[model samples]
Every structure is written in C-alpha cells, then in structure tokens.
Target: MKTKKLNVKSRTENLSLIRDFVSSSAAEAGVTSDVIENIILAVDEACTNIIKHAYKSYPDGELIVKTKSTRNRFIISITDYGKSFEPDAIPEPDLQKYYRQKRVGGLGMYLMKTLMDDVKYVSIPGKRNEVQLSKNLKLTQQNVR
Candidate 1:
C-alpha cells in the first residue's frame, strides 16, 4: 500500500490544494478518470464540510488529509480538530423538498455519500473527527480502456 498525507489550515482557499492532491493520488492508484473525478468531488465535499461546519468558528484549526491506495482500493481520510459531527445525525436530504424550497445548501453531505463507494465518520469528543472515503480501484480500473 502507498499513502500520502497533507496538513492545511481550515480555510476555503486550501480546497484547490486538496483537490490536486486527491487527483494525483487517485491517478497513481490506477483509478479511471470518471472514478477519479468522483473521488475528488467526494473529498472536496468532505473537506468543505469540515472547514465550513466543524471549523466554522475556529479558523485557525487544522485539517489533515490522508490518501492511501492498495492493490484493490483507493481511500481518502480527512481529520479535523474542531467540533465533532455525528454522521448518523445528518439525515438524507429529501430532494423533492429541497427542490421545492429551492434550497442551495445542505447538499454537501449527500454528495459525499453518493459519490464514494464507502463513507465513514469517526469523532472523538474534544480530540478529533475523521471522515474516510474509499473507492474500489479494481472495479474502476477494469472499466478503463
């Protein structure tokens, strides 16, 4: 397995850096373009939530992003030292209601869950919160020409 890690301030400007890292890591893992794009989007959504929600009131907090790949899978893990969030507490958005109300926000978590093969969250009170997103590279690579 191969792994890479990055640490950045919990700010919006750092999103591009995170995207680039995820893209490169996914490519290295032999993930197809479509899968790589989805992985990037999922990671971005997770990080954005960490920055905008978990670290909302603590701008100086740090976010640690880790990318790992094995023979069969690619994974991205994001950790934050801010307010922990319970993944189960976030209900699946009702798309019909969202569209009827013309809501613009509250879609990040939904996108993350839908885009990645597996999404898991772990939060330790007063310690840290970690969100893990994984994609099965074997399946994705098999689709490549």
Candidate 2:
C-alpha cells in the first residue's frame, strides 16, 4: 500500500492540498475519474467535519489526513486529537425534520456515508479520534475502476 500523511492547522488551508493529493494518488494508482471523485468527496466531508466540530473549541491541534492505497482499495483516515466524537451516535440526519425546521446544516456526514464504500469511527477518551474511510476500485481491462 502507498501511504502519505499531512498535518493541517485549524484554518482549513489544506483542503485544496488534500484534494490534490487524493486526485494525484488516485490517478497514479490508475483509479477512474468517477471513483476518484467519490473518494475525494468523502474525504473532504470527513475533514470538514473534524475542522468544524472537533477542533471548534480548541484551534491549536493538528488535523491529520492520512491516505493509504493498495492494489484494489483506497483508505483515507482523518485523525484529530481534539474533542472526542463518536460518529455512531450522530442521529440519522432526520431530513424530514431538517426540512420542517428549515435548517441549513448537518449533511456532511450523510454525504460521507453515501459516497464512501466503508466508513468507521473510533474514539478513545483522552487519547485520539479517528475516522477511517475506504473504497474499493475494480480494474477493467488492465485499468483501475
């Protein structure tokens, strides 16, 4: 597997950098454009969530973006050492209530789950919070899908 890690500050200045890294990594791995887009979108959603929620209180920690790729799969894990949040506890974004309440937020996680093939979160109190995301790309005619 090919792997790379980047440290981002609180300002979200590394969003484009993250996207570029994902795109280049996927392209080199021969991933299709559609698959690459999906991975990038999912990763972006996760990173955005961490920046906006996890580090919202303390803006001094680093947001770790790690990208890993194998022959048939790509995994991106975003780790934050800020507040502990368990993704499992997030209520299914009650879209019905959202529409009735006319709220404009709370859809990042929904999109992440929809776009990524696998999404899992692990939170350790006073330790670390990590969300591992993955996607499987099949090869078609000697090329990645």
Candidate 3:
C-alpha cells in the first residue's frame, strides 16, 4: 500500500487544496479517470462537512486528510478534532421535500454515499471525528453497473 497525508486548516478556502491533493494522489496510484473524479467529489464533500459542521466554520480548526492506496482500493481518511455527529441520524435525501421547502444544501452526505463504494464514520466523544471514503480502484464507471 502507498500512503500520503495532508494537514490543512478547516476552511472553505482549503477545499480546493484538498481536492487537488486527492486528485493527484489517485491519478498517481493509477486509478481510472472516472473513478478519480468520483473519489475527488466524495472527498470534497467529506471535507466540506468537516469544515462546516464539525469545525463550525472556525478557520483555525485542523483537518487531517490521509490517503491509502493499494492495487484494488483507494481510501481517504479525514479527521477533525472539533465536533462529532451521528451519521445514522441523517435521513435519506428527499429531493421533493427540498424543492418544496426551497432548501438548498444537506446533500453532502448523500453525495458521498452515492459516489464512494464505502463511506464510514467514526466519532469518539471529545476526541476526534473521522470520515473514511473509499472506492475500488479496479472499477470504472461502466464496471460499477
């Protein structure tokens, strides 16, 4: 397995840096372009949640994003020391409801689950909150079906 890690402040401005890091790392690991895009989107969503919800937009909060890649798998682990929430508590998105309520947002979790083969969350109270997003490197968009 090959591993790479990045530590960035939990700010909206750093989301692009996170995406770039993940994108280049996945490409170097030989992940397909389609899979790489999926991984990038999932990672961006995960980090955005960490910055907005966990860190509550505090610019000083730290975000640790680590990538571990093997022949068949690419995994991104994001850690935050701010706040943690229950992943299961989030309900499946209802697009109609959002349209009716004129609400935007709340789709990051849903998007992550849709784009990644594995989406896991671990929260240790008063410790850290981690989100692990992974995809099978061997699969292409067509192979996914």
Candidate 4:
C-alpha cells in the first residue's frame, strides 16, 4: 500500500493545493483521467465541507488529508478537529426544492457520494471528525443515482 499525508490549515484558499496533492497521488496510482477527475472533485467537496462546516470558516483550524492507494482502490481520508455531525442526519438532497429556493449549495455530501465508490464518516467526540472516500479501480459509472 502506498500512502501520503498532508497537514494544512483549513482555509478556502488551500483547496487548490489539496486538489493538486490528490491529483498527483491518484496519477501515481495510474488512475485514468476520468476516474481521477471524479476523485478530485469528491476530495474537493469533502475539504470544502470541512472548511465551511467543520471549521466554521474560521480559517485557522487544522485539516489532515491522508491518501492510500493499492492495486484495486484509492482512498482519501480527511480529518478535522473543529466540529462533528452525524452523517445519517443529513437528508438526501431535494434538488427541486433547492431550485425553487434558488439554493446553490448544500449538495456536497450528495456529490461526494455520487462521485466515489464509497463514502464513510466518523466522529469521535472531543477527538476529531473524519470523512473517508474511496474509488474502486474497476468502477464504470458511479453506483448512486
């Protein structure tokens, strides 16, 4: 298993840097461009959510991004120390309602689920919040609709 870790402050401006790290790591695993793109987008969404929700846009919180790749899959784990929430509590997106309300946000989790083969969340009170995303090396279209 190949592994890499990035420790950076949770700031909106650092999203691009995070993307670049994911891109390079995925490329190193020989992931195709299409799959790599999806993985990148998913990671971006995860980090964005951390910055906005977990860190509450404070910009000074710590964010840890870890990557591990094998012959059959690629995995990304994002951790933060600011806040935590139950993943099951998040309702599925109501796109029509969002459109009617002119809401352009609130779809990060949905988008991450759609773009990755697996998405997992963990929160340990007084410890940290982590979101793990993985992409199978053999997936075609995503499983989620």
Which residue pairs in candidate 1 have backbone atoms (N, alpha carbon, C) closer than 3 angstroms, thus clashing?
Answer: none
TM-score of each: 0.90, 0.88, 0.93, 0.91
> Model 2 — TM-score against the truth?
0.88
lDDT of 4 at 108: 88
Off by over 4 Å in 1: 100-102, 139-145
- Distance from true location, Cα of 37 in model 3, Å: 1.0
Question: Which number leads on TM-score?
Answer: 3
Report the error of model 1 at residue 69, Å: 0.3
Per TM-score, what order, best first?
A: 3, 4, 1, 2
lDDT of 4 by residue, 5-78 (tens): 99999999999999999999998877888899999999999999889888889989999999999768999999
lDDT of 4: 0.89
Task: Give a tens-digit lDDT track for model 2, residues 88-139.
Answer: 6777788889999997456888888898888999999788899999888785
State the lDDT of candidate 3 residue by residue for 1-145, as single tens digits. Answer: 8899999998999999999999999888878788888888889988888888888999999899999987678999999999887898888889999999886666988999999999988999899988898887665565356
Q: Candidate 2 deviates by what RMSD? A: 2.2
Native-to-model Cα distance after best TM-score fit, residue 5 in candidate 4, in Å = 0.8
Superposed by TM-score, candidate 3 places the C-alpha of residue 87 at a distance from the truth, in angstroms, of 0.6
Counting clashing residue pairs in each candidate, in order, gives: 0, 0, 0, 0
lDDT of each: 0.87, 0.82, 0.89, 0.89
Arranged by lDDT, best first: 4, 3, 1, 2
